[model samples]
Target: MTKDQLLEMVRDSTQVMTLRQKLALVAMLSMPAMIAQLSSVVMQIIDASMLGHLGTHEAAAVGLVSTTCWLFGGVISGLATGFYVQVAHKIGANDAKRARSIVRQGISCGLAFSACITLVGLLIAPHLPVWLGAEEAIRGNATLYFSIVALAMPLLMMNSLAAGSLRCSGNVKTPSALGVMMCVLDVLFNFLFIFVLDMGVLGAALGTWAAYFITMVLMMYFLVAHDRNLRFSLDKVQKFKPHWDTLSNVLKIGTPISLERGVMSGAQVAISGIIAPMGSVAIAANTFGVNVESLCYMPGYGVAEAATTLVGQSMGAKRQELMRSFAWISVMLGMAIMALMGVVMWVFAPEMMAIVTSDADVIRLGTEVLRIEAWAEPGFAAAIVTYSVFVGAGRTMGSSVLNLASIWGVRLTLALLLAPTMGLHGVWIAMAIELTFRGIAFLLRLKFRLKIRE
Candidate 1:
């Protein structure tokens, strides 16, 4: 058979699967990743819930520092996306050696970048809470939490690199499985350190650090032990040298993705700063609401990952039609899942907030925000899944530009105008409006782009 015939067979095989089959495949592929993602979010909830017992001041401290850590973490993860997507494309093209080389380069880059983040985060640790306008009562604990996370930067970055590399090669299960394990371990460790030992916020940070270390080790094991195309060998080290061309390619795709995340992180910090002066009640309430919202939103992210992989592989195979199909299907799946979640959140908002805190005021504020954001889930789902499609197609520049514009131009602008007048409600309103705009823009782009035909 000719090469075209072989390619046709592969495409036909994948396409022939039923819609239920497709959803199942996507779920099976994304479960571990989803579980892992869920675990991280669970840890956050657990951390806050545990700290909530300590007092609102302690819970507020964790909330204040959490966004900054996300910002730092986001930048590293963004950098990893650069290499991981390339690996996905390469593997789809049947270039195993090239894919392995890219993984090595990613490791080298992750280490270097992690070191820089560690240095910068440590330097800013003491002042981060102050910068965010934290009250005197929570500032010390906030600084401690921030410093511990900063110290774990290397481990977190390594874990991200390993997970991203494995997932790109079409082995999402390993990373996802490890992620669940990490989450479980995180909660267990946090329970021991925080409750039993009474270590406070520092204990929570330590639990996270330990969890990341465990996940990174497991990820490294899977990459070496099971990944056929990704096994590292000393002999290959002799052949390895910095390939500027490959590095440049990875960075070109990755930098924009990272900047998109980094800018969003910065925007979170800015938004936090804006909300800070509103008092600790507003700060704690917003933080809890955001975490609760993640329960609905994260599944959309899981579907988005599947979209990235499927679309990236399709593009690599030069099956442009498949790419378009994958994009639409993924977005629909994301929207459907999240819309369902939104309904659940709206109906059970009080119960969800209760899981995080017993504070009457915090729960009251959080439930209100959750109910409002629930209506915006479909838009959020569309934006996330479509952005994954663009990233998979190596359209990072467009995705980045759109993300920055949506957040800074639309979201922030609306928040500035409305926050003073509406308080926390204004922030949620701005988010819903911006998400709607973002979703529409992405859908329009997908419609206009020339479809890839077999």
Candidate 2:
């Protein structure tokens, strides 16, 4: 079947469903992705809990450096997004050859980008904690953790490229399943390495690295062996050279995303700087709270993925009305789901926090911050899904600008101003406020833009 025929098949299969049915379909489609995200977070929680047993210093070491690693990783992921989204659009437009070409470019870009990041990350890993203002007790472990993650950067980038290509072809299920498996494997490996083998922080890092390598292999096998729209062809490889046109197109879509993520990473560092002087307890609590809260936020991310696929395809087919309809529907659904999650989180904060730590102080502090942030979950959902909508429409630069302004202009400024005075509570309050603003701004953008029909 042609690519357009395939998209029509998907749409027809989905369109007949009732609103509830469509939501259900979306939810079902997202379940594997959700599980993938949940498992990943669960592994982190497990890793943190295990390290917490080694004393707060080890846990803090991992916590302090994790965000920096994530920052570097996000840039690579963003680069893949460009080519992947274009693949979705091309497939929708009934151009499989073009889609494959984009995929090849994504592979090339992902490897080159990963190598550059790995080199920089390795060079700076030793001094990262000192630069972040980490306490002397936690600095060495933090540096080691950063170095291990940096070494695995190329594998992680390749995994992102494969997963993104799969998702773009409307194959979310495979990637999601593999992601969940990756998380489970990480936890299992961490158990053996950290406890059974007594490798400490190194064990945790190695486990995560192994998980990525395995997942990358699995995803590659599926794309090459099973996917009809994407298969590795020796003939294509012989013909492949860097296409400036495709590279420029991908970067046009991706650069802003990278900047947005990069800026957010910077803001995280800035926020960390503000919280650094407040003492270890506050920093640790903040770290725990962020990870715990990811559970609530991740579902929104799943919905956003669906939105990106649906809206991008709609745009490609020149179904502008459908694109707008999908965008609004996705935003509402995401917010509703997140709002419910927030309520549950607020009600059960202590119980949830207790699972990750035995210390009364950490649990108490974490519970408070989680509950506080829970109030802003709906707004957070709006920002998350609307950004997806913009990306689907090929309007990423504006989204990136909004994200940077929101984080630096609103979130960080408020965080810095409040963290010293209010402690962790102050930092979360700033986050809640910024999320609300981001949602409002995105909603307005959606309203004001001229609806373009392809």
Candidate 3:
């Protein structure tokens, strides 16, 4: 069926959808989102490959600060989620006016929030590499690269808000298309700055900054001026005023998510610290391994995005059975796809590592760790999609607690104990074990704990 027809099915609360119909709808929504996610990863891969040729240190510098960057990005996701999930609920309840108001307030509030984070990032940029235990030689590049990306934080926040708004509105195709466009722009800009201007790590950051800026503008324009439901000029709503109820709901839903992402990303930063003291080769290998793994797990995130939209709308419509069905379908589909991807990654681990970096030591180490990670994909998929289900139902607190418990209680503790003895391999082994455990926990929670209604 066409996307328009599929959207109709989503909105048709009375329609008793067949199994084929449900699967088709999920596939339609997921394919575009999956492509968009992969494109974002490809942009990273391109940056790493370009920097890899410049020498191991340039790649290592970015690697050193990557997790810290994710920490900020996670906050952006938290802010956007609060707004877009509300938009989805409003639309599902057939309240187009309310959705538009939420969109406007969300943009304003999200910008203000991102500005605070940008300030914090800027203040810490210079000191971050040192804190992460980077080699003295690479610290300067790491600081410069992070500072450049920090300056674009507002753009990143807006991009996320716009994309989330679109996805919740069932306009996944637009965001996915823009994502591909952003990747193409990244290639052009990276070549201009990195090759033509002879900039190294600094060039990579600038290239990414320029791409995000341009796409954020286009994304916001489409969301605000073009989208049928959320178009700003469609109604006489207060554009910037924050309604107490809406704002309160946003905070209630977003706070736990922000905290979850914050701590989870902090754990990643901590892991980076653990790997940092192992020297540049180990750092680069860990970095490359993460990039390759993204290739396998990003599709799971794509399915998760679909789950959030489906579940949020289902919840809004008070369709408990439909919500449960969508949740199960999304998680099962994600697991199957990622399980297959795990095999692909395991078989081609060496080739993938070679594409990212030329250094034999880095490639060998990254390949070994990546194969270890392959075994964790299905479990990782389970965790990723199930969490999105929780977020969609506005039941984030329990999942967030479980996530924090798993990451800290299990992953970091094991990594700390194992890293000194077995090196980077030990750290990855710890990660695989933790992911498998976390997945099973989430699956049980989905079956027993998640309430269909409040």
Candidate 4:
């Protein structure tokens, strides 16, 4: 067999693309996504570095409520997924008008949902730090940070909808470019709000809020006015409100994914509660450790975004071979990049931690956890990209269930058992083991699904 056929990760792709062409196609789609995701990680790393200079207490304060913030953020993303998946499918089917129609409906529904989130966040902000068991000294920062997040919810929701719509329409460059712009805005704002104003953690939060709000407006403008697939004609009647059928289709695809993210994010909140009592050093370490790992996992997330869009479009076009080929290619590429990153993380763990913080104890502990976690990075990448493939193919529920079970059943249970004895090490070990299991399971599932086609 020729080398191209031998490297074929999926049998169906035999007639779809040669090895060189597939690699080029994956790069065309994945590069923009990679850039966007990397920008996000850089934003986080910068935030962490800025906060770290304020000492362990300031860093710990943000860490205490980070998971809670993620919980809400995860749900919001889920909501966006509902509408955008349909857009992807429509675009794949070469129905640009329908895709544009979905964008309009998405904006309306997303804005309404965001309004509700804002109200909910306002009600919950004052009390959330206490609920998460944060120390009294740190609670004020947590409260202020969440309040800003609440106020920015509308803008964030708009950005998510607009960006996802663009991605689905095969225009990753605008969103990627916008993401870099947002990161730059965030850094500048944080410098003024945090360093110049000396606002500490609250300043960090405000900067983040301003960045998203501005980026949202810019991105939304692009989607509404400039996008090829999403720019609707002005004369269309009932332009904003989508039909019930269209709305349902979005919900049908997005609900399972939302539910999955909701539960997983909630679990993260619970895990954070467990971590809160471990002292400021531990909390800082946990936070910094997460950031450090971002260097390794960011590529996986980037590749996953590409897989989702490519697979979603392929499915919409009813090109099963193309979808399978894209899926395997993305997954393999993600695994390879992440594996290399993981090795770098292992060797430079201390340096990575040092970049984020100067506290010797915090850096030392964070480095250890990162090294322990690095072993699982490739598997983690596998699960990340594969799930996106599943989502694109309208098979999100099963992957969601597997992820949920792995996090809650395997990770949390082990963490609870190990934390008392092993402290932060225990918690991270549980995470590592769960990620490895999750990755293997996802790959097996992908193999089985392809086997059915054979």
- RMSD of each candidate relative to the true structure: 3.3, 2.7, 1.0, 4.0
Per-candidate TM-score against the hidden true structure? 0.94, 0.94, 0.98, 0.94
lDDT of 3 by residue, 358-420 (tens): 999999999999999999999999999999998888888899999999999999999999999
Candidate 3 Cα deviation (angstroms), residue 52: 0.6
Cand. 1 Cα-lDDT: 0.81
Instruction: Pick the winner on lDDT between candidates 2 and 3.
Output: 3
Question: Clashing pairs in model 2?
Answer: none
Candidate 2 C-alpha RMSD relative to the actual structure: 2.7
Which stretch of 10 consecutive residues in model 2 shows the poorest summed lDDT? Answer: 9-18
lDDT of 2 at 172: 83
> For candidate 2, lDDT tens digit of each residue in 1-454?
3333444644442443235544554565556666777777787778777876777678778888878887998788888888888887886676767778778777777888899999999999988888889889888989999999998988987788788778767788889989889888988999999999999999999988998899999998887667777776622553346698888877788999987898799888878877777767777788778878888888888888877887777677666666777788888988998999999899989987777777788889989999889999999999998998888777899889999999999999898888878898999999999999999999888877625543
Task: Give the top-scoring candidate (lDDT).
Answer: 3
lDDT, candidate 2, residue 81?
86
Q: Could you give candidate 4's per-residue lDDT for residues 1-454 as a string of tens digits?
A: 4322322322233245667876776787678778888888888988999999988888888888788777777778877888888888887776778788888888888889888988998899889988988889998888888888878877877898888888877788899899989999999999899999988887898899889988998999999888876776543753777799887776777777878888998888888988999999999999989987998888888888888887887777677777888899999999999999999999999998999899999989999999999999999999999998887776777888998999999999999999999999999999999999999999999988742122
C-alpha local distance difference test of each model = 0.81, 0.81, 0.91, 0.84
- Give the winner by lDDT: 2 or 4: 4
Q: Model 2 Cα displacement at 258 (Å)?
A: 0.6
Q: After superposing candidate 1 on the true structure, give the runs of residues whose Cα lies further than 4 Å from its correct spot.
A: 1-24, 233-240, 450-454
Candidate 3 TM-score, true structure as reference: 0.98
